[model samples]
Target: MSIESPRTAIVGLGITEMGKVFGRSAVDFAVEAITSAVADAGLDLSEVDGLYVNPGIKNDTDMRLQSTLGMRDTRVLATVQGFGSSAGQMVQYASMAIEAGMADVVVCVYADAPLQEGKRAGAAYPGQARAMVGVGSLPFAAGLKAAPERYAVAARRHMHAYGTTSEQLGAVAVAAREWAVMNPHAQMREPMTLEDHQSSRMIADPLRLLDCCLVSNGAVAVVVTSAERAATLRQPPVHVWGWGQAHPGYVNRRGSEFGLVTGAAQSGPAALKMAGVSVDEIDVREIYDCFTYTTLVTLEDYGFCAKGEGGEFVASGAIAPGGSHPTNTGGGELSSYYMWGMTPLSEAIIQARGQAGERQVDRHDLVMVSGNGGVLDFHSTLILSAHPKGR
Candidate 1:
């Protein structure tokens, strides 16, 4: 049975370079991409009706990104601090607004100048700031360190419980690097071996340096509106089928287990149900890869594989290009530019649009992208297709 299509579409997308970004401010990069996106969609600046920014660690009101981009006139303006995971939520909001006649067009954008110096250099929004509160201080108390501790224990437990190996975990880095070799924008394009992965210095007990995602500077933006209006736009439109967010409510050392199984696992089925699709029905995936452990945990949570089988599943190379179900073909955060996993969200849209260039999939009809934020405290998932299937 052919599913009926919905009335929302992603009409445009834009991305900044992914690297050290020594000089350009994050908001500046975002404006560059968004401007390109508006032109690409054949829409004038006056057409935009809403603005949503990620407001990452390097964000500041001084940049006045909304006004600078000439989107301040939009009827709705929103600032969210949840990193890449906020993509789905913003899209959902835009969908709702379009459905209710609140706005005709919405653009979601995120950028961070973490590498840029000044008072804003280290000024992440308060929630993200709190997550890293202890890093630069006396004893290194940031959640970056704390998250690894929790994952080290989880990895150890998974190793003991499922016989997963360090080599198996390293395979993720290896496979991602392999795909990175094809992505011109990826930062760590050079290949590495499992031995290289295992031999790399350890940040946490089980996490080698290679197992972590690089911190780079970049911005990504996407434009959304009613599917009826999108059909008249310059570019093809990809529809949103389903969307959801889940929070696991785990935060500190004492709540390790709760945190491990938080948002990703719990909310995945709900999202799939809303989309009226199963895991096997998804042709492509863009799971967040802030860390190897994150990918490992999210795969299981999202029902891609049986619990505790993520290591083996990833080792099968299913996530690489030309696999049964490719994921993060733009190299993901592990190899691609990182705006705290925001570009992956945009890349997912590109894949659904069938414009992935070198990394395009073979006849992908459905795609899913999951974003994890706040030590896994928040999870947001989006289901997209070339044509919507009645949400």
Candidate 2:
């Protein structure tokens, strides 16, 4: 039998030491993360009947991981990828498998070691200009091959159409840094300000250095099981109430609302509807922050505020630590380790479990986690709660 909504529980979370560490490949980190998650859930390695891996940009981790882990039998195993949206998608997939009796215990993991020896973090993803050709050549001609450049086009458009300013974007970075200062796991915990954001060198017009996310080497993993089984687990169960994904294809043509809006517009409401809750019911938000502009647009699309008012909304400190909306309490990708969507997904689990320590919000009965991949191309949303559905 199939359940209309799977109430899978995230019982364990494994996060390896994040940032600048060397000599370990993505596979090595994956081994540690998965094993830690298994142990965290009070389960033996043998109990993991499914494995879902989202490899880093290096693409070094894959299905063979089952062999390395010595999992002689697994009902489900695969490498899932949707750029940054992979984490939420993995949990959603694992939940379905559990509800269908396809697997018992599953571990969804993401690991990357992009920072190389002797190379600055910036070199991890070089801004090497793509070959100038076709519609993509527009940014290529301007030497904007890197993500910041391509994303800048979208940020600029949002600015022009809605009067978004650089200061508004800086507000996002500054707020992330503020939250990071209170987080022990954050990579850049030093205090930051809007001035720091403004003075930082401009990576792309309208996108400053601080406006971007940090590049790091790390891995994060979460364990999923049926809500019934979670009762016997070691940690408090973070119930997965609902999830939704949107892979809206983009086109490089006039009249296309590419960057101005994102898949979050579709996925957020769908997930909320499935959870039988409204956005106002969400107590915490763990939005993927690949860039500052990403957070702003997602909030707008998620209906956190009126469309085109994200700049003013964020500038008012609505998402800051003490703000009405507690967002990215683990510092997010800006100040925290960048584990792709896992950064936000992991934090959501922490908050839902009420284990965030100093950064934990007082009201975390309901949480919303968002993942956006490929410059607003793919989007996924997961609704988690301290209590199970229909409670």
Candidate 3:
């Protein structure tokens, strides 16, 4: 009735090869991960009566996992696309369904192949669309073309306002690379330095190539069951302590640099409140790092730092392993394969499970994983714990 009162728990987790599971179709990747995760949970495939699959933009198909993965029949199915936010939606859906007695075991799976790598869709822009009535740039580039000046302007403004420097931003790249070096599954394990980040080609103003994430083919999955059932599983359950999604419904058609910070400010508080925890209570974090600026804005909006002090907070190396909040220990999307931020979800589960190996932290009870979508206009925050809500 109330989305399973205390919370749901993740009993099984699985992640594919981080870099290039090339030659394999996206369906194969999804099936493999689903199979492994189900096995890890010590459950038969038949027990997976619920399935949530978030296909990539290239996946023009249904949420039908039965045919691809040999699933018998799923009582619950959800197929949606929110990029980074898809998994969060699936988790929320799974929680609600279980509470309503729709299904017992739910598996949220995401897999994407670089199938559409070279093929860019040339549909009419939103402004030019016949069905919808939009203004300005026909179809907005999410501030890409028109407000091209704004991204740089905002980063420059953030720097001038907070005394942040380019070197500080590069530090994030350096630290992320350092962690990637320890991750055998990471795509970019090669060590990078501040000098390297500074000299890389610039994609957008104030954002270098190294500051952006990589694109690769991979899949990740999670098995969610009741906390009561999780207690009997092989591994300790990673409880879903709190969850919330805040869609400000603000389309950044105006091309303002303020969207990242402002949008996050809207969603962060709502999530923390639901968990009944403060930012200080989180021991680990896996914020979406599609770009270096995303993490900076998130820290400020999430109250980890003052409004304009994100650069300093990141520069202090406080986010590295053994720091105040060791974030994205699997190197994140910035340093690892960008599986639509799904890998970070797996990393959070690993951190909460105390299975992060070298990057593992002490007192790692709770982890906060935030996903940013549609220019930060859509936010999904999840609080994962080492144990279920009630003792």
Best by TM-score: 2
lDDT rank order: 2, 3, 1
Clashing pairs in 3: 126-139, 127-138, 127-139
Better of 2 and 3 by lDDT: 2
Q: Please give each candidate's TM-score.
A: 0.88, 0.96, 0.88
Evaluate all candidate structures by whole-model CA lDDT and list the values in order: 0.74, 0.90, 0.75
Instruction: Give candidate 3 misplaced runs (Cα > 4 Å).
Output: 1-5, 115-157, 160-163, 251-257
Output the worst ten-in-a-row residue range by lDDT, candidate 1: 120-129
Model 3, span 218-253: residue lDDT tens: 688899988889999888799888787776665446
Per-residue error for 388 in candidate 3, Å, reads 1.6
Give candidates' CA RMSD values in order.
4.3, 1.8, 3.9
Backbone steric clashes in candidate 1, count = 2
lDDT (Cα, tens digit) per residue for candidate 1, span 119-140: 3322222222243344354333
TM-score for candidate 2, please give it: 0.96
Whole-model lDDT for model 1 versus the true structure? 0.74
